[model samples]
Target: MTSQTTLIVASPSAAGRHYECRRHVTCAMDDAWWKSSRHRMSQVIKCRFLPPARRKRLAAAGTEYWKSQARKYCDFCKCWLADNKISVSFHENGKRHKENVKKHISQLSKRSAKEFKQKEKLDDEMKKMEKAAMAAYLKDIQNNADLTSQELNDILSNGEGSSKLVLVPAPEKVPVWHEVKSESGNYYWNTETNETTWDCPEVYLSLAEQEEQKLKKQENEKAKERLKQEQQKDVYKEVNARLAREKMKEKAVKQPELIKNKSTYTSTFGPAERATKPYGSWTPVVNKPQEKVDLQLPKSSKEPIPVPVVYEPETPRIEFNEKKVESLGEGPVEFKKRKFNNHIKRNMRQKTDDD
Candidate 1:
């Protein structure tokens, strides 16, 4: 208990009146914390006073139990009938409801609406344009018919005046209709119809020039091949120049002018010769047997003494015993050492000296 938070709890008394019972509670929780949340409520319950009821009364006419539900209904939108704050606000803010409001406002006075006036003006203009276009179209057809009649009368007058002059002159002779043949068989033109016919000739000298055109195309193709070869040669030369530059770089790296060659860049061996090659051709030779020298030791008159057998000694066994080892006295192996009696002997000598 380390707080001073007071809470009101309603308790039913025998007098049939609910008392405003307040309790001074102490807790780690803050007094100003939210009273509706679960954590603060649990903390309030642990104070040992009678807890507030699980279901508390909100209000006599709260938002959930409002008798004036008509207040939530929008008067402007008659069909919009939501009975809560969130739904009513959403419906009022919605697009269809906003459009309905606009329509209602526009219908109040058509003359006040600029859009309606503009639409009426557009309709009137369209009708006037259609009528003008129809009248112009009818006038154009009448004018075209009158022009045709005038042209017909003029042609008749001109023909009457030039009839003798046009017929009296002798007609010039055209080249005789000769049948022409080529590698692609024979074909020709008709003089009477002035169209190409399989039976007659038309100079239009294209037949004679086809072979020359084919030869020219062949020459052009050969020229293109020669140009391509020249391009390939140029490319090869560029690649060779690049290779030479790379070789010069490698030579400079390998044999830098520490001892500058007064001679040329060419080595003693040709460019194709391997740098790691031997001076001459190697010959395969047979391996000769080696003669070993005999060791001549001095022989004595006495017989040679026999050597003695060298014995390999065995390591001693380290024994272990199950009995408890005494802290005093000597033991069998080197590891089992006894404690010295020097302290006891020194104490005895001190006692005897005191006596």
Candidate 2:
């Protein structure tokens, strides 16, 4: 079927169209609705567009005279007579034809009403088109060549009516609000309430509105806090400035007073007591602050140590009964061993303090 081909005849008024048909196009066969000569004859005569004279000529389907009329006719309705057919006797007395006739009349009335509305719409559209064309023409004339205001006015008055050109004052544009959804879900500005509200029931709307207002209130609070901070800073600056001025005034007053009341002697106290302190002043030595020091130690402790002591003397002791030299015989004097001379010095200082 795909490889099979057919030729479709084209006309000057219509394009060539390919349609699926069981019979060949050249074969003298009828497969489509309203293609029969009788149906075509009947429909042509019934068409509302035909004149009475033409209807009468095409009404006689079997007659040779009826065959001379134009062959082309397009059927708007797709009714097939197989289910739609009726015996002449039944058709004359049938409920089907009666029902169809009533339906047709009803449909005709509805179509007439629709056509009237469409005609009004088309008339309005044509008027708008004319207005746009006139505007474009006037704009072109104004741009391409120079014309005086009077000439322009005269052209406007004569060329086309400007009273209607006042433009239906451009239909008052209504704000068309659209819904903006986010991760938080649906929300939009309500023009009537003049606030943002949620897409919910009347019961929840107030709660949603409260939430929204709460957010706005929080923002307002933050702004108020910032304003308060700025005011505080300004107040602090003003206070500091005032304090500095007061201190300067007090100092100025004191300067003059001090100058006027200056002492004949520069000393603020009696001469003996007014003497300056010496570089070194006395204080309990324990109370004075001490400097820090670092003392390095041996890296390792050598634990094994020997004691140092001298038990044996180099000279022999003299016996009491033994004969001695004349100087030594006077007395055997004993002497005490001292480790260091600084200890003796410390003892002497203590004695002096005691005295």
Candidate 3:
């Protein structure tokens, strides 16, 4: 059984006519089909910016979504979409995207309200602290006013009917206080209590305070006298120092002349034994006349001076025994020395019988 195959070519007239494939055109235009086609064609991009995915996603990946050449990103849905207007409109019209936008707005409002409450609470606490500080300051001012009134009463004293005598009780062994003035302020010292203060004491003219004031006046006078004495002593010290410096200058000037007058050579001492020391620790040198040695010549006959004869020891000789010597050729053999070669060739040695 043999099978036959046939090929048929279209005519020129049929080629000129265009043939079109037709589907159900009405079905393609239907809203349901369009929705299905849109859904099938469009890609669903998962948002890395979402709260659940943000921890695991890289910031660099999220940055790519907002790039000019990339797809469109929706701020409310926190997702990327196709860059076309149609895709954007479709996404915006969706129920899920609308709900996400509403939820985002609510979250923003809640966060703002929480921050405002926190700021208001902090302001209230600050106001309370400021009020407490102001109260303390006012109390201190009231105490200072009372002290001022008492001071005024003491300063304006009348004979017999004095307000100081009436208000202040009779003196009863109060602590002695001394006032010292300084550039910063005046400070008061209580000798008995050993306390110090910048403010004046309440009992200013007590018997003890009066005695201390008297002592302070005496001490100031004595201090003035001591200061005068110290100034005199300093003047004397400066004069003494100047006189000493002048004396040293004169001594230094005369030192070279004294050294020149001293003789360098002496008969009693050799030059080495009588070496001169430095000026700081110099010893006085005594001048002595040099002594001359008289040489007595042999009177008539000249006698030859005898020369001493000295003998030196000879060095010991070392000899080897003839019996200990073996054959002359038995010793280490001497090889001819060779000149050094600049290039040393290290090649693989040919295998020999020994190898």
Candidate 4:
């Protein structure tokens, strides 16, 4: 009889005796054991599991199984079916198949609404062209008809009774505003429509009149601007006149004295007198004689005589007195002396007071 054995694995970290059995064998399932022998056994078992041709056949069968389960929709016939129904219909002949063909043909033959709109637009354009051609024919006939130079000028200039037209200028539009008195005692113009609160209708009428007046004022300003631009061609004349007047006024106000002096000098010594004078002489001289002259001398009873005063020299006075020698601090000492230089000096000495 042959014996059948079962392999048992254990981790190397377990500390136990190896168990022996008649039917099964146990071994440590450690990394060393796998590297030694079990790893090769795993590779051999994996290789025996599936071959290359079997794997390919298995992959193809799986794809086919998935496709058999997928949902199917017929867009042309507008229907949904399972795989079984799809295969059965593909094998069978039905009206749906013919309808799909007709549907595609109809899609190819049908025109869109956009193309119809374009065709209608083109028809309108052709009608307009026909009308224009008719108008041009009538215009050419009218142009060939008899027409005077005055008539032609009238038409060109858009005069009265000519076929040519003149566009009338549009009337100015003024905004009508409602007047409202606020709590602050100020009036404001309200653009929104509202019920009239005032007792007198004349107030609203007057407000409208005020708005019209404002619009007229704006028009007048525009007209004034146009006139001013037209007058700019001769602006220098007005500017020069204004500047001359300003200069004259400024000179009169700022230099009145100078103007007066110049006027008086000119009147006193005018160009006429200057022209009459010789070229070398510019100044004028006037001569006047003395009013009176007196030739008088001082009167003396006796003739004045020169006198010489003679005086005997004073006798030299010598007096011997006991002299006292005073001892003062060692320093420069000064002495006082009497002087008689003039009468003014004597008066000054008498008027001075010593402190």
- Highest lDDT against the true fold, candidate: 3
Model 3 lowest lDDT segment of ten: 16-25
Q: List model 1 lDDT by residue over 173-282, tens digit each.
A: 54434344644456453445534334433453345565665798899999999999898677556555655765887788878565565554555665675667568778
lDDT of 2 by residue, 231-340 (tens): 86775565556557658878999998988887675557565654477666776657667998878866667776788887986898876776656664567778998787
In candidate 3, which residue pairs clash? none
After superposition of all CA atoms, the RMSD between model 2 and the true structure is 41.4
lDDT of 4 by residue, 1-355 (tens): 2333332222222222111122333345455754555442332221111223433554565421111134456566666555466564783357776778787777766756668889999798667656655554565567775445557777768755546576999996644444554433423343455322323333343556777889989999999999987775455455455557658877888797776667444445535554465666666687888687666877889987989889999999999999787976799888987666654753454655768
What's the lDDT for candidate 4?
0.53
Task: Estimate the TM-score of every prediction.
Answer: 0.20, 0.19, 0.22, 0.16
Q: Over all chains combined, what TM-score does candidate 3 have?
A: 0.22
For every model in order, what is the number of clashing pairs?
1, 0, 0, 1
The total number of steric clashes, by the backbone 3 Å criterion, in model 2 comes to: 0
lDDT of 3 by residue, 226-292 (tens): 9998986775565556557658978999999999999875668555564476456857899999998
Candidate 1 wrongly placed segments (more than 4 Å): 1-185, 189-196, 199-205, 257-355
Candidate 2 residue-wise lDDT at 325 = 67
Tell me, what's the RMSD of every candidate? 43.7, 41.4, 38.3, 43.6
Q: Count steric clashes of candidate 4.
A: 1
Candidates in descending lDDT order: 3, 1, 4, 2
Residue 279 in model 4: lDDT = 65
Q: Comparing 2 and 4 by lDDT, which wins?
A: 4
